[model samples]
Target chain A: MEGFETIIFEKKGQLALITLNRPRVLNIYNVRMRDELYEVLSAIESDSDVHVAIIRGAGEKAFCAGADLSEFLSAPAPTFARHVRWHRDVWGLFLNLPQPVIGALHGYVFGSGIEMAMCCDIRIASEDAVFGLPEVALGFIPAAGATQTVPRAVGPGHALDLLLTGRRVGAQEALAMRLVNRVVPRNDLQVEAEKLAEKIAGYDQGAVRKLKQAVSRGLDLPVGSHP
Target chain B: MNSIVKLECDRGLAVIRLEQDPPGPGLADRLAAICDELNYNTDIRAAVITGSGPVFCGDAATAHGAQAAFSLSTPVASLNCPVIAAINGDAIGIGLELALACDIRIAAGMAHFSLPEIEGGLIPFDGATQRLPRLVGRARAIELMLTGEVITADEALRIGLVSRVVPAEDVLNVALEMGREMAGKASWALRYCKEAVYKGLDRTLAQGLQLEGDLYFLLHTTEDRVEGVKSFKEKRKPEFKGK
Candidate 1:
């Protein structure tokens, strides 16, 4: 297995796990983490030994609280664009991965954190998980894919309800709304996510890949139509 | 809009085109009638849906006569076989809702999408309010409905709104390919999977799992399942009879 510095990368059987390690700052995504994430995702994508990927945070405080707001203050426009590109690339990795990517979410899953989780194929959140996109409150919008992915996962009215209100939603509500696939006790998040990953990994890889591609691709086509 | 629905079936694949020119108004009733016809027709295993003109569909209702437009939801819910949308052009408002109602949506490269119901001093009454959130998530769906901004096909694909984005002219071809592919799959399993997914959406996990188990038991008794296993053992293609 390939090693990561800012994030922990490990593999158990067919599962590849990526843990966001910056718990002291609640795993806020900064330039270093973003770069490292891109690297780790790319590595996992290329690793034939890996059948599934599990993403989670290192500590109990947060999965991620969005981009490092403090880092934004010092970055120039071009640099910011570069950072955005990097983030998008990482998200693309999660979205396009052949194997399923499951998000193990807990604590505060906000802003970019929610964006990241949305990119994954499946999301399993802890009971204490709090999800929101407070960018609008800061006079900024969710520049990440949140503007697109969030609405698609939920629905227009509910998506609007959350974006407009910027209120935090709990895990049970998130699952009820279909925002996340499952909600478990905080301590059971990893185990539950891992179990889901294991179930997915045990399936026919080609069939699963084709199904994911077909379903993902089918969403864009017209009803009864396929490209 | 009244002329949007057309039926074509070939080699077990069914093609349903949305040929209405926007503003798409009267198309809903026609779609409902077609849905009625399809319910009785047994030939098609998988179906493809697309637009007639450059635009896949526009708002279901125009400003002049609000009550004249048809509702896409009724026909959408009535569909039995898997429906895929080949969005060849812009899909907005009810157009977007129609796409949402389908099992899958494929868009043309030039396709643009939006839900402007919020800006029109009305909510997305044609299932957009409910379906969009189910497909995307609460935050992103709200942004589109509230802002009424159009997003490109690529953006739609990235966000999970639509499944695939193809060249404008290739929309139908791609949809046909998918229809054919699906038609080749185990018909009973496909139907059960579709039913389980949609029906289980609003149910609790236990209920959903119970439903899955029941359906799985039923599927195990099907001729197709036995043939599938036999075919696997023999390394041959299974000729499914859809029983």
Candidate 2:
């Protein structure tokens, strides 16, 4: 109903635009962002009018640099924190969205950022976008869905390389890894992401949802279980 | 400890070499012991298994009566930390199975790979039957086995059997460097990442997601995780205690 401190949620003509609003810190994912995203994603999932969603960041510097490490490590109580994490379940929310999601990515997309982008059905990265999963360098694995989502996106070889070495890749390299579906000029990222979102939003909602389910659920089935 | 298997430990890395030219009997026990050593030696965060001379582990890997005991895959795959197979030469038959059990592989340019156990009227007794198909897909894995085709290092790389292919001399160094890089990071996280991939891949999608989520939550309880965050905030390299 009102504004969120960490995200901008707007809907127009069956399309939802969810912007990561903490531009001051390159939209590093924080607890507030997690809560706001849970709400936004939940809203999009339930609302029949919202046909598709476009997620982007509000800054020139980054789509999302990574998770806010300070907030992530400081916990009230182990049990409570773990419970809260499961309750928010931001990555699960992203993956389970009924409407197809598009990631309009730019700048530093690292760690949780990479995981988030991979959750999207489609991703369009700006030329200036730089991607990485530097969790290994910091002494932790990517606690987000990266270990699973990334391999699904880039295959195990490239995924293992990026995860193990904590190396950063440019937008071109990310595209080559198939991490992002399309690359565009920095200025054109929003336009392109919106164009794709608009096109999907215009399609017959039932058919569009079925197509997403067919492709994603089809991948999950065991080899012989289908054919 | 034995002449058949030479092990060297240094700053968070265990380098195990197959020194036995014609790998003698009891090689499996020696390897299994090394795996146990790697598991208990908290100091050693990663390992590289390579051949000392030309061949990685020459023949006799799954040789009839001793085949069950000689499976190279079980011990290597059981290691807690990330394992890199520095395939210095031909990794044929069960040797290739050894390489497949590793989490990553850096092969020598002169190296060759094949699953020619069929010629001996035997199917690969080690983890090859399952691991090969997973790595290169069922079709290619079958093709390689059915044809008994020996693929070059470049071909192995193309098929995703090995991650990198370097000159014969550089293979060990490359694999060692990769192992060292992984060792320097938070060791438990490395284990967690490996577990998520290896364990999650086999389950149904929902089960895989659940497993990944479980591991992700479990990391929050580690001190290294807190240190990782604090150091990031401080703008200094995190001192991972796991090392």
Candidate 3:
């Protein structure tokens, strides 16, 4: 937590909250945010006192807009960029976190925003929230885990529709598609997210973590093989 | 040669109707035979399957039950062409199994669905135990099977069990309407799409994506694919001959 700047990490009881602190830019994911998130998530992974973690954005506008084009578009070279990406493994860290991560999303959730939200074990979206993956339109694909995780949550058809068309989806439609666990009124987003985090924290952490492992691993197995 | 399972093929759409007044033990065999006919009938592009009676199967004659049901449903799962189940009434036990085997299901407004085998101390011997979870997820699947509840058409639609719902009288006609429309597409692409989805379910995301890319590439080599591209350029509907 000492090196954190782009994000805020705080522990209240057993719940650890990670808030994207870049409200000025709508929390656009940039080089700095990526580096800070990697460090923060690593600390959360090792912190046994944190039974559950919540990721949200500061202010009312966005969970995250997308990548900071100013930084990404001017990156060194393709080969060096690949190495930079390989060194972090931020998305893998998000997925491998032992504690269940809940995403409290609102406003703009696009491209890397949606990808980040997809990594969370449970997602609660505000009614005003919008989701999309605009990478395909930008002549690139979602290099993040969106390609895989989106399909796992919403099935191939819906995932393909969103990825190929790059269309925006509202909170209600996202809920219907199983993209988010549920949708709440914009005003009630924080309350709903906190209540859920507290409830999950109240449960036996051992059983909860084990159950998450069973499901995450079980889905990868062939149909009849799950024991 | 069984009268209970009637097969009628016209144009590119095939309709299979199960018409056992009180479905006999041979229903399973007849269903298997119907699966074989559809598989061999290369001209057929899409299929509509419905049961003719007050109930789809008042109760499917579960002859040897588990093993028999598993063998019977295997062909449906692997059908090269898409099959749409026009569920007209209550689908319980093995009857529900038959509908679950189809690619899409359109249930009648009055229809009810259940897997009451648990009430009899038997689990779903068919693929329901597996397919249900894939369709609706594990928690709901467990609740449905464990509690053995009968859900209405609306409830089924809400849970993704059936894709659509129509009046009881229109179940067959609606299914035929949809079948004909889908049958009119590029047959090669239709078959490949279904294949990728059904097979993809068994593979990892990376593997599934690879399989999809392979099948998509294979489609480009087909005559129908060429015609499809040509038709789009010429602003006319492509007449696909399944080549």
Compare the candidates by TM-score and give the number of the best one.
2
In model 3, residue pairs whose N, Cα or C atoms come closer than 3 Å (at least 3 residues apart or on different chains), thus clashing, are none
* Pairwise lDDT winner, candidates 2 and 3: 2
TM-score of each: 0.54, 0.88, 0.60
Winner by lDDT between candidate 3 and candidate 1: 3
lDDT: worst 10-residue window of model 2 chain A: A218-227
Predicted candidate 1 versus true structure: per-residue lDDT over A1-227, tens digit per residue: 34555689888999999999989989888888888888888888888888889999988799998877666534454445544564456665767788788999999999889988988889999989999976533323454456556655775434544553356899977886679998889888888898899998999888888998887766655456434
Across residues A1-227, which tens digit of lDDT does each residue of candidate 3 receive? 77766899899899999999899989989889988999889999999899999999998899998877665435554556555655777877898789999999999999889989988999999999999876533324455667667767876445644654466989988998799999999999988998999999999999989988888777777558555
Question: What tens digits encode model 1's per-residue C-alpha lDDT throughout B1-243?
Answer: 435567777866777777666634456677777777776766556677777877888775555335644688668766776677889899987888888887778799999999877675777778887788777766788899889889999899777788668999999888787678667656556555556556655554234434544554556455665565556446687677776
Docking category of candidate 1:
incorrect
lDDT of 1 at A22: 89
Ranking by lDDT: 2, 3, 1
The parts of candidate 3 lying over 4 Å away from their true place are: A1-151, A154-174, A179-218, A221-227, B21-25, B61-71
Q: Each model's number of backbone clashes?
A: 52, 0, 0
